[model samples]
Target: MASEWVVAKKCLYLHLPLALTSGGSFLYMEQYIVSARKYRPSTFASVVGQQALTGTLKNAIATDRLAHAYLFCGSRGVGKTSCARIFAKTINCTARTPQGEACNQCDSCRQFNENRSMNIIELDAASNNGVDDIRQLVDQVMVPPSVGRYRVFIIDEVHMLSQSAFNAFLKTLEEPPSYVVFILATTEKHKIIPTILSRCQIYDFNRISIADMVKHMQAVAANEGIETEPAALNVIARKADGAMRDALSIFDQVAASSRGKITYQATIENLNVLDQSYYNRLVDAFVAQDVATSLLIYKEIREKGFDSQFFINGLGLYLRDLMVAANPATLTLLEATDDVRQQMAERAAKLHPTFLYKAMSLCNDADFNFRQASNKQFLIELTLIKLCQLLSPSPDESGSDEGQMRPLESFTTSSPAPHPIDIPAPQPAPAAAPTKAPTPAAPAAVHAPVQPVAPPPAATAYSLGGLSLRSRGASAAKAPTEPSPAAPAPVELHRSKPYSDADVERAWGTVRRSFPAEPMLTGIIEAAVPARKDGDSFELAVGTPMQADIVGKQLATINRTLRNLLENDSVELTVAVCEGEIPPAFWTDAQVLDHIVANHPAVGQLINKYKLRLD
Candidate 1:
């Protein structure tokens, strides 16, 4: 075996200058190469995402426990071939280190580096996988290294070998020449013969994590003098789906097209990937139960050329990532930059886990049915509507057994405060007109009714749309008669405590449902998210100025109902085009510093003294 190997080596490198030179002075210029090939790992430590396998291989070499045959199995682009090459090179290093890594300084290492080494052999089993090919490989195993300690044979895509090929090579693989070592690599291990598997040591490689991929891409970009945002790198990393080579390829494409810097927008554009902003806005709409906005966002996505199924899948993944980011223990599973993670955490903070789970289930179901449905657009729209509904408050609590039943009309929602059902019936006014207050005797008359009106529960407020059932004379609305001048004074009705944002939304939704005459307005109100800026001053975000004007016209009516339900007379409303956010182009800065400075006296004085132009 050793004599044959020496003879092959002597013939292999008998010619030098692996690089072709003209006139023995000028070398041929290397053509442009992709980053994936340029940055291929030459050492185990340099291999991108297989620490366990690499570590085990090094330890085996260090302990002098070399296996006769080894199998490297994993998905494509996961460094299987790279690891095999590195292992073969390390074993043949003439001056190997104590840590069991190649020195790359000896004659054997130099020949391998120049791709002229006869000791290390590589075969592409994917192409040459017939019985004849296997017979030839078996014959070659008899040879040993010329200067190195052993002969290494690396057969990549070994699963492609035919049954006959397997049978032909089985004996040689099971018991190779004493100076020979064999390495088999495949993306599919089950396809390989069981007899072959039994003889080789198997190393399973894992998909490279997004965090590792991002760090590696960052290093490559830095070395290439390309400036890339962490967010952009993270996007490319996630798109690579846990393959370092794929990530590098994507990074190369984006860097080439982007203008000097690789921004997140540039990557999304280049990859044709849906922007994260869309998902962010979609989640916002879901939380608000804004069906109109959700539908519109989906339409926008469609207009952008994204497939419905793709959108559904992306939404499912986005929710999954948000779910992972929501918990500290699972946050490590989120594949994003700290900035993106923080944004996701903020969004997640607003969502209950139940809502997130249900939202994900809706998206998954939509994805499952997307291809089967004839009208994919409607299917997706319906799915989004259902998702919005999951976060919406029920119009009436009558569905629940806990809520007492009453005649629907017996509950009056015509006014801000609930009206007495016992009052004499009267013809109703037009829907646009304000409801009139009942006469003074209405309260006394209410005490005479045999029907019931339940008192409000603690920490709970009931809307007039849903009946508050109570039996007549069940409670004392009667003037206390000075508390009978004996027992302690009667308990006053509980005052309304300040409500949180959730409470405000719930109350507002009920109020909207109460006005069944204006279905469109009710929907608009449902879509708008109301936020409290100061005591009693709530800002409601609308999609358009027209919506703002419409809501503005109802400002008095809405404030009255909200104040009555919330029991805060100071309750106020401000309808604006959402969170004071607008397109930057709209301002174009002639929005005017004086507009802001008018509120700040000190800043106004400074501006006036400087004679600064408003523009």
Candidate 2:
């Protein structure tokens, strides 16, 4: 049945023209033009995008300030070679032309256009990257141009040249003959050595803009008599990513597939590209924290033969675009259509900055580890799950009353209210001290009635100076019942001498010595300074909030030890986050080692021998 259909289709096509002619009718048949050939830029003005680079070159030519060695650096298909060829022709053309354009009518220009110009030399360094090739090129450079005044050598993919080959060509590149001009083009500038880079006048070409590419595509479509949707052309332009050659290739594929009538759907289908709607759905799923839906979408794409890596990469790029749209300063960098941009901006506004940062980080990490992962699909799924988690508030940030509620042990029952009490009463003296010192009870008896009993003050309610129990509410609280004579009154432990600076310093020394040898713990202690002494309490100033938190956890134990040594039950500790100089002695072992390695060459050598990493 298939063979029969093929024969019937062929017969109909073969006889249709004959049948039409026999009826005495003349129907004009449009000429067929491939998109790549039809859309090729014919003039400097016709080149899509790259206006700045092209304009600069033209102006330079007009001013007669041509460099002997030129290096064109950019990605593929941005017209590096085409520009070089045009520049070469414009320079050698004998005929006078406006705007420094090549006169195609001139003998030199005609020869170049016909590919028969002896003065112009073109080499693909990719296939000819060897010492012998460079030697041969040097030999050719020794000869003068047969027709044009200057001989031009255009080498594409010059970075492909081997190290030896690059070295061989260096002398000639740096000091070419008066009549010889060299133009080297490369997509990978980093691969080229500094010596080679220094020898050439570098011209970095930018990726063509989507607007310029679309406009150029429209012109090509008009000239070819092909009806096309603006939206379709825009999609083609984006898929090209600022490369005119890629855009033309996509254009050709779409034009053929759509039979000269291109629409957005047809272009996307022919390109085997995921539609914008897919990206939209993926983003929606991500925002909604629908991990299943995200995974399903990924699976569908994978089932459709799209590469996992490509899909992941595209998703990352899409996320990057959305991130850019979220910020006004970076919105201009988004290359999507106006409708897509608006959608992105709306979605970006809904996303929290922290969530966006986390999602981007996850995607980047997944991308980096994708190739090395054993289960690539699972890796992507995991990344999507992580991204979904970003949409939901973290457990620590959910504001759940239960999560914030402390255990019974952590709660203080001294307060009348349901909230935990924050009373900072002095620790009772040990049993042995009570038997030894009966005089200690005298101060307590004297001050106990005078010092009114009051509710523990909230840290927020009280100022740093001190909380005044007497002034806040002396009349509201009921008096405490007198204790039995057997239960001795609490001793009002006091220092005969107020805490001196030396005492505080000694306390700091004891606290510092008590810290565990762990690097992280030591680091916190080192950054903290003894700010001041208030009665029995010592105030510690930490360098950062993080350091303050670290020391705050250990404050109770530290205070107990300090108070025990001082024989003062009223001893207390306070930590305040402050900005101050980090002491030199605070350096962790790793920091000290790094400092030594960075400053002393001998230490660096020793470090390298041990293959050590700083903690």
Candidate 3:
């Protein structure tokens, strides 16, 4: 069997590339290593974005105060597992560096690097999470290390362990052998049982920053002799969303796709990232109120295969950045290259802060309803149109159609008028005294010759024979001579009139009945009866401030109704919340009944004898 295994191994190496061929030629391809694994940190100082945590671990190792159990918790691809492996290897190294890092020259460190270490054990709890598996682990804990002082067991995804498994491993984990060390790692620490958490010292990992990822990628690019642009790397880092592993993987993909040369335009195009140029142009169109150009640009974007919702969200983010850039103090909030930020600031200067606010709000609204909108493109187009109109002048004082696109006629082209039309000058009419003409012609110049009167201004005058009037700037047309109706006269309120307390109470009752829908307000008003302090002053007594607040909301309506009903404009109503020692009469039936029964035994006995109940 040994000889056969030797022969098989020889054959495997010799025939490894036997089947790989392209174009009838043997293709000898070099082994490719992924950046994530190839560049993984091997020592404490080499780990990126976790200096504090690594320092703490190094200090613990230096002090010889390592805990029996440790929990490394963080999101995916944040170096939790890597750090655990490094810690385990460092602790097991016979000769460590002065900085408490593992010395690679040591036998244990060499074994760990070559994946032949016997002191370190890794268990994938995601797969082996049953009680039986945990029992096996507990049994394995009894054995001492053969080459190292401690046997390190690293359990990855420890939260996946079953409840029974957790319980079975709790005792062993709490009081393991002196040479045993358990390291638990999980993406979700909250899922792990509290008992397991209590037995372990927890160390949380944070998501790597974009700058760190970009710097690491730059180093990786330099090592690989690949050309890259900072903007492209920035885009890749953002696309990774704070995962260093994801960023490296994306960097590799982009590098391969671009044939070792990565540029900003190519990167964005390859990743389907909408270029900021589109947003800048859109803002220009918005400032100019160019609806047609904006719609055309939107059509072009749609043709490029961007989703409407994605476009909306991108626009919103752009507008938000613009808002930040619009103010010099808040310019630091923008995350972009200096050139891009300066350009954004320049663009933002042309836009009013109010315009940016309203534009962002419209984009947000469009994005919020995007999923439910059946005609999504129309919604997007409408949003764009609204954004365009945000900078347009308001049409009326009421602002009824503010932030809305004007009619299509507003965008239509028209020729300039040849010359400005002149408004006709006003002509005064000649005043004349009425004279009685001769009933019958006397056949003589009995009446003096009548002087001709100049015609009245055409804008408001009616001709005797024409029976028509021409308004200013309006075409000549006959209009009916109907007089407009007069407006109604305002009601005069009765001020300074005196009324009785009964009148005020009746008015309040009417007010309460008027609001049946508002049961809370009605009940409050019904309970708090109004008491007349003087002929004009009235006070409402409520049991609590909450009731007073409810009544205060309707105070205006109540006062108006009372004034009209009582025929007294001088009547004033006020609300008072009883601060302390409310009278028994104001107490609720249940409270009053309890008080009576508690204070007077006879009252309870009488009620018991009669078998009476309070309604």
- lDDT (0 to 1) per candidate: 0.67, 0.64, 0.69
Q: What is the C-alpha lDDT profile of model 1 across 1-615, one tens digit per residue?
A: 565445445545684323323223333244446799889988888898788889999998877799999999988889998888888888888688776788888888788888898988888998999999888887788776678888899998998988888888888887788888899999998888788889999999998987788888888888988898888888898889888889999988998899669999999999999998999899878765678999999999999999989999999999998888878788878877676778788777656565677789999999888889999999999999887766332222111110111111111133232221333334444344432211122232222212211223324644432321211122222111111232222233434568766567666756665533332234346444455656767666444333344455455456655764676656666664422333333432222222233234465333323222221
lDDT of 3 by residue, 1-615 (tens): 565455556656787543323232322446566799899999999887888999999999999999999999998888998999999999999999999999988888999999999888889999999999988888889989898788999999999999889889999999999999999999999898888888999999978776677788989999998899988988898788767889889888888889888888889988999987898888878866688999998998899999879988999999999999988899877765565568789877756566777789999999999989999999999898887765333212121221122111121111121221233234332233122111221121112111112222223323222311211111111221111123121235456666554555555546655443333344456545565655676666554444455466556446555665666667667665443454455556533443444445465444433323333
Worst 10 residues of 2 by lDDT: 406-415
For 102-218, candidate 2 gives per-residue lDDT tens digits of: 888889888987889888889999999999998999999999888878899999999999989988999999899999999999999998899988888999998887877887888
TM-score per candidate = 0.63, 0.56, 0.59
- Report how far residue 455 has shifted in candidate 1, in Å: 17
Sort by TM-score, best first: 1, 3, 2
What TM-score does candidate 1 reach?
A: 0.63
Of models 1 and 3, which has the larger lDDT? 3
Clashing pairs in 2: none
List of clashing residue pairs for candidate 1 = 452-470, 452-471, 453-469, 453-470, 454-469, 454-470
| Candidate 3 TM-score versus the reference | 0.59
